[model samples]
Structures are given as structure tokens and as C-alpha cells.
Target: MTAETLSIPGLAKPASRIALGTWAIGGAMWGGADDANAARTIDKALDLGINVIDTAPVYGFGHSEEVVGRAVEGKRDKVILATKVGLNWQGGKIFRDSRPARIEQEIEDSLRRLRTEYIDLYQVHWPDVETPLEETARALENLVKAGKVRALGVSNFSPAQMDEFSKFAPLATIQPPYNLFEREIEQDVLPAAVRNKLVVLAYGPLCRGLLSGRMTADRKFEGDDLRNHDPKFQQPRFDQYLKAVEDLKGIAEKHGKSMLALAVRWVLDRGPTIALWGARKPEQISGVEEAFGWTLDEADMKAIDTILTRDIQNPVGPEFMAPPARNRVQGQ
Candidate 1:
């Protein structure tokens, strides 16, 4: 299907598939992060015909937005811009703040940093437990009313939370990490979104590069890298994940696609609004773009589901929290 056919709240659903995720465009792992590389990545995606891009102010703690702004400087209309608020990542730390005042301030800051007056799909990166969900919802609704954001959405929200938040405003989309290794959202979050007719923006669809079958090199990350500290990539569980990656490769080969391509296609095949693909390299961007020409067949999906096995084995419960190279059960 083409972006024109894909209908969502505010963003232009791409007729072709593949939404570029700008997180790594700011360089999360390989430290070559700079304005030039980021701008080039965005330009490359557009040239390759990828239209939708998902980002957040916390990514590189606003550095990502700056690069995105400069990259889309002249061709903003050609691409769909999606960004988030709530969680602030600054000085290598994450803190959630959804107070009315902070939300208002962040919206203005996001507009300035993005170099655009309106954000296509503005989302709350995460729920602020301290702030009443209703208050946060109203703040986002107010932004819409003020014409600051075209659409309002949320990320990493639970089914119950999604329903609660929607009462205050019309939720256009909800982003959650969904991949072969992680399917928690499928159980609750997805049903809620579908019931409400809200778009499901599948983030981390490639499992932070683990599903790409490139882990054979045993590449190591820096101390601050999230994957470096993640339990799934740790030696104890690395082999298991490596096995899963190989399964992806095998399945992709049957379809004449790469593991990366298959990984993206699986998510796209799921009934959702879009998949947020993170690509630091130009080649990765191209590979993701190729995943949308068609959908995966049932037999392929069944075998894939069987082999991928829901064993994230994250010591910290979620894939994002486990310490790097540590056992999923912890201290293993």
C-alpha cells in the first residue's frame, strides 16, 4: 500500500512504506554523530522515497532535533515529522516531566529546535506517574487547540493508560516497542489502540539491530550505549539472540530479503499505522525502505513466530533496562 492509502491522524501515511527514525541519526552507538551526517541521512531517506520520520526531543537530548531541523530545512513538506515530549534526556540521563508548565514549555522548545511551527504528530514519550493523566491530556489537547501540534499521541503507554488518556483528547497514535523478541504490546496496547481506532506506531521493530543478523561480529558498545548494557546482548544470552537472528536470516532468504528487511516487514505486516525504523547508516535506511513492497505470508510468519521465541530474558523486565552483556535472569 502507498502512503496516500495509509490514513492516520495528522501525518501523511506513506503510500510506500518505511518511516525513518532519527534517533540514531544523532549517533547513539557509533559516535560519528554530527549535524552533517544527520542531515545527510535525512536527505538520503527522502531521496530514496521514504517520507515518514519519527523522533523525540530526548534523543541526543535535543541534538537529534537540531540535526533533523537542519536536514529538513528546505524540504519539510516532503516528509512527515513525528516527535515526542514528556521524558527529557539530558546530560546522559532520563527524567519524566509532564507538568502543565513543562509540557507547555517543551512544546515551544520542540517547535524552535525542529525549526518548524507545527509538529505533525506530537506524542508524550512516556506517562508521567506524578502528574494526573487528565492534566497531561488537557495540556496536549490545549497545544492542539493553540495550533502548536497538528495531532496528539503517546508512546510506551499501557492499554489502560491509553484508554484513560483518550478521554481527555482524541488520540491519533500510540507508539510502543514491538518486535519478534518483544510482544507485550500485542496483548493489551494493541487491542486498546485498535478499539479506539488509534494508530499503532511500532518502535524498535528491529530490536535495536539484533534482528539484523549482524551480531555475529560480536561488536562491542561504549559504556553509555543502551545495547552495550542490555541483557539480551550479553554473552550469556547473546548466543540465544544470535540464534534468533539466524532464524530471521533463514526466513528472509526464503523470500529473497535480508534479515533487516524481514524484520521491518514483519512489523509492517502487523495491522498498524507505521513502523519507526532507526537507521544510523545510509545502507540501513535503504534496506528498511525495501521491506514494504509486499506483506509476509502466513506460513512464513508462523515459522518466524515459533522460532523467535518470546524469551527476551531481560533482567530488568523490559528490553531497555537490562545491563549490557548480563544474563537475563541476572548474575547468571
Candidate 2:
């Protein structure tokens, strides 16, 4: 089955509802990545009708974008390239920096790494409290004028931030973490997107693989896997989430879908225009087709919520994933 598609104002064509997220493909975190396999993963996504590919400069400090560049080399027109600026790393430390000068330099670096003349969608990875929002917005606006970027987007920005940012530049999309296990965006972000008529790109659709039904209690993480520091992966909380996943299995079975597919479908049904599915290898994205052409009804949503409330007594948000600001860094 072909994946569903959504239209963004500036894009030449509609983007696939499911975007291939390349955080893991960066090879710095989530164990490691093999270049050949990563390319194969992108090819697989294209074969399965997923046209939008999302990446960031900091993902492996630019390795992910390079891998993506190679993967989509000859078929650039067949993909919607989405990447981020802001959030710079120095001497092994990462911090938010959306200063115009920073954005200027980063965009060039990103374009070179992605091997593209213009990005389809360029986003600010995170809000930089230190820099004036107008400065960052204007810098990105410059890119649009220069024909280096087609559309503008912001990820992890609050409604107020988006309002301020839009005052200086046109905002076409808002990307935030939204999944079955993480619905924090529904509280305010989603509403803001609706009011502004911005397309929502919901990342982390599988909640970092916790909702994939493949994670086990005995599973172990190696290398720089971010899950090693995630609160939900800790002992008591991990067990709690696993228990909820176990109960949700019956629901997935009832729908004749894998837990991963159910997770992505839930995000799409919740109103996001696209669900960013993170995958580093071909087999990792095997069941993506199943997420399309089906959705959860009121009773299914309510049942899922009931299970979450019953099993997870100490629920948590994805706050831990946020990086520290430049000045907030220790011993700075």
C-alpha cells in the first residue's frame, strides 16, 4: 500500500505522511550505523512510498546528512528533504544557537553535507533563549529569499515562540515529538499549529522504539544509545511502560497490526500531518506500510489511555532529550 501524502504550501508536491527520520542513521548514537545499510534503508523507504526524509546537522555531527545525501543522490526530485539548523556542538558539547551568523554558516554546511542546492523544508532544531527570535527568523527568511530553502519550519518551539518567530518570517510547519506514549504536544502545540494553519510533523512516532513491541525487559543498550539516559528506560519506569505495551498488544492484535504500526497510526490520527519514523536499516522500517489506511476510533483511544493510566503510575515527558543552553553548560 502507498503511504498517504500531505501538501505543504511551498513544496512542489505533497509529502508522504510517514517521513524517514535519520537520527539513528547518524551512527553516533543508538549503537552505530553501517553506511550501506543506511542507504538501503532510504531506498527501502522510497520503495515503500515514503518520500519525505528528515535529518539534522547535529545528528552524528553531520554524518546522518552525508548518509542521506548519498542515499538520495540521483533521485533528489523524488524526495522532500527536511533538515534543521541551530543547536551547534563544540569540543564534544552541544548547545542551542540560532544567531543569524550561526544559521548562515550552518545552512551552508548542511547544504554541502546533504548535497542539495535547496532544502525543501528547513527548521530550527530547538528554540534558543539566548538569541533574539527575530534574528534567527530573519536569517532563515534570507535563505528562502536566496533560494536555498523552500519552506520554513520550527521544531520544539512553544506557541508563543512560534508567534514571535512568525512575526519575522513565514512559518509553514511545526515539528514536535508526538506518539502514543508521548502526547504532550496535544496540550498546546497542536492547537497552535491549527490556529496558525501550519502543518504538523510529529517526530518520535514510536517513542524511541518503546512502543515497537520489540523492546524486552532483558534488552540492553550499548554505545551512546540515548535510551540509556531516558527515564522511561530506567528499571521501574521501563517495567511500567513494558507492562502498558503488553496490554496494548491485545489492541494491536485486534486491529491485525504490529505494535509499531499501531503506534504510528495513533500519531497520524491525532492530527499530525506526518509521523517521522526513525530507522537506520532496511528491516527496521519493514512494517511502515501497515500504518496507512487505518486509524483509531474513540473507543480505541480511550482504551489505550486507560491502559497507560493503569500501568504507568509515574509517567514522564520527553524532557530529558532537551539539550542544555550554551550558558547553562556545566563549567562553562
Candidate 3:
């Protein structure tokens, strides 16, 4: 295809309905992968009309960004590239660091590795209790002013946290984990994001691997991946998680889609947010494309919500939706 056809058709676009999640390109989510695979995965995503790619330096210990740099070479202008700061790479694992100095330094490093002059959407990967939210806010604003970044966002912010940061600058989006198993976001973050005109970039819309339907504990990742660490994998909850997935399997079969597609469609039907489809392999990546542009009907929506709410032990917690007191100021 010609460059124009591949390139994002518009400049200064608000955001697109489909975004390719590059966590798999980073290749460390489950560990034990290569740059070649990551590069090819990105190419496949672009060919499939996924013009938005989200990456983070912490992904693949900075190796993912380097791979992406190589993958998108000669076609940098074709896609909207979004990456995160506030994620630290150290001791062979990723951790959170939202300090203003760190954010600046990491973005510089990210630009160097990604071979980009500026990031399209630079986000605080997560909240840093150690630094004031305002400090992080100001740092992001400076990036925009200097033209080092196009927009700013935060991952995993509560309503109050988003509000506090907005006092300093407009937030383009908020990235949070939302999925069939994690529908609690609908109670507050979704509505609050809508009120503020912020995009709700929903990460983990597939619930790691459960909603994908290829999961089996027999498949294991080395080191402490979030799947192994997440509470749902533990005893009593594991059963609940399995039941929910199995229940959806029937619905997916009836709809003639994989559990993955059903899970993604559920998120897209929720509202304005974009769902990050994590594809570890080319075939998996291809499979997810079917989920695009499809909306879940009311029966499927109600069924999915019932499965999620009834399975979660604490639907009211921050893991689902933050408390109301913390959310009141988010739209202010």
C-alpha cells in the first residue's frame, strides 16, 4: 500500500476507535520472546488499520521501544504513537516512578529508543504516592508546551486523582483496566471520564488471558507476572474466574466469535473509550481484528455484566471503581 493510505488519514485526530496495544511488542509481559516477533506483530497491526499503538519504556526493559522504533521505521507518520512515563526499569522488572525529573528523563530515553522527535500521547503510567500529583501534572504540561509530546494522560487514576491533576492541565485520556470481569469501572470512572471529555483507554479489556479463552494454569510465565500475582488466580477466586469465562464461552459460540472478540466488543459497546487488544502472536493479533466495529447487543451486555459483578468479591473497591468521595471532583 502507498504511504498515504497507510498513514493516519487526519492530523490532530481526537482518537480512533481501534488502538493496537504494544505490550506484546515489548515481549516481556510473559517474558522469553524476541525483537523479531515484536517487530512483525507491529507490522501486522498496522496492515490491519490499527493506527494507534501504545507502548511503555518499562515494557521489555526498554527493549520493546527499540523494537517498535525499528518496526515503524520508514512509516513513522503512519500511526499515532503513544507511550508512557513514570514506569521504571530496574532489577529485571518494571516498577512505578512518577517523579517529574524521572518523567522527563524517561521520555528522553523513550524518544531516543523509539527514534521519535516527540511522543503523540505521553502518559503517567501510574500514580506515584511519593510525589504530589501537581508535580506530575506540571511536568506533563511542560512536555506539551515544549512540543516534546502531543498530549498527556494517566493510567490507573481514581476520579479524585484525575481531578487533582486536571486542575493543572487538561487530561486527554485516562487508561484503566476494564473488562468483562472488571465492569466496576462503569459505576464511576467511565461517567467521570465522559463528563471531562477525556478518553477512557481501557487496558486489560481481555482480563489478561482468561477472557481470551486460551488460558490454562498449565501455561506459566517465568518470574512474577501480574497473572500469577493477581488475586483472582488464588484458590476460591480462581474457581469464580473460570466459571465466568466458561459462561461466556457459550455466549461467544452463540455469537460465532471467540471469547476474546466478545470480551473486546463488550468494552467497545461501553462508550467512548478505546480497548487495548494485547496480541502476543501474529495469529492472535489477526484474530482480534474481528472485534472491531461490532457492538454487543443488550442480552450479551447484560449477561457479561452479570457474570462480572456476581463473580468479583469486592465490586465496590478501587479495583473496579473508586469510592464516590474520591470521584466527585474528577469532572470539576
Candidate 3 TM-score, true structure as reference: 0.86
Clashing pairs in 3: none
Report the lDDT tens digits of candidate 1 across residue range 77-157. 886788898875434556677778888888888889889988888898887777789999998999889988888888887
Best-performing candidate as measured by TM-score: 2
**Model 3 whole-model lDDT (C-alpha atoms):** 0.74
Could you tell which candidate, 2 or 3, scores higher by lDDT? 2
Residue-by-residue lDDT tens digits, candidate 3, 1-332: 21111112112754555577877566664655666667777888888777778888877778778888888888988878889988664455445667888987988899999999988888888787667898989988998899888888888888999999999977888898888766667888899988887877898787777778877655565664656666676666767777778788888888788888888877887877788877656776766566764567888777777776776565322252221221232331
lDDT ranking from best to worst? Answer: 2, 1, 3
lDDT of 2 by residue, 1-332 (tens): 67799898789999999999999999887887789999999999999999999999999999999999988999999999999999888786889988898999999999999999999999999999989999999999999999999999999999999999999999999999888778888889999998888999998988999999999999999988999999999999999999999999889999999999899888888774799999988999999989999889999999999999999987998999998887876344
Models sorted by TM-score, best on top: 2, 1, 3
Quote the positional error of residue 95 for candidate 2 in Å. Answer: 0.4
Model 3 misplaced stretches (Cα beyond 4 Å): 1-11, 89-95, 308-332
Clashes of each: 11, 0, 0
Query: How good is model 2 by TM-score?
Result: 0.98
Candidate 2 CA-lDDT value: 0.92
Query: lDDT at 290 for candidate 1?
Result: 58
